[model samples]
Target: MGYCRSKDLDFAFKVFEEMALKGFKRNEVAYTPLIHGLCVARRVDEAMELFAKMKNDDNCYPTVRTYTVLIN
Candidate 1:
C-alpha cells in the first residue's frame, strides 16, 4: 500500500505477486489495496480485472467498497 501511495505500481505488483508465491492466502485485505493502487494509477481496467479475478481466480466475493471503487 505504501508503494501504491508512492505510485510505484510496478513494485507494488511485484509485492503482490511475491505474496501469492509465498503461499499467503489473500482476501479483501489484499485485493483492496492492489485494486485501489491500480485505480490510483488510472489503470481502472486492470483494477476491474483484479476485482473480477477476486471472484473467478480466488473465489472471493467483492464487497461494496470494491464495486464502489471500480464504479467511480
Candidate 2:
C-alpha cells in the first residue's frame, strides 16, 4: 500500500499478485491505492486494467472517487 502511494507500480503489482495468490480479500480500500498510484504515475492504461480486474475478477465495483481520479 505504501508502495502504491509512492507511485511504485511495479512493486505494487508484485505485492498485489502475491496477495491474490495468497487469497487476500480485496476491497475498495485495496484497489483505490493502486488505482491512484497508477494515475499519479500517468499509467492510465495500467490503471484501467486494474479497474477492469477489480470489476471482473474481484467483484469490487469502483467508486466515484476512483472514476474521478481516472477522469481528471
Overall local distance difference test of candidate 1: 0.82
Give the candidate number with the greatest lDDT.
2
Candidate 1 positional error at 35, Å: 1.2
Cα deviation of 57 in candidate 2 (Å)? 2.4
Which 10 residues in a row give candidate 2 its minimum summed lDDT? 53-62
Estimate, for each residue in 1-72, the C-alpha lDDT of model 1 and write its tens digit. 688788888898898889889998778877888899898788888998888888775656788987777766
User: How many clashes in each candidate?
Assistant: 0, 0
* Model 2 error, position 37 (Å): 0.9
**TM-score result, candidate 2:** 0.83
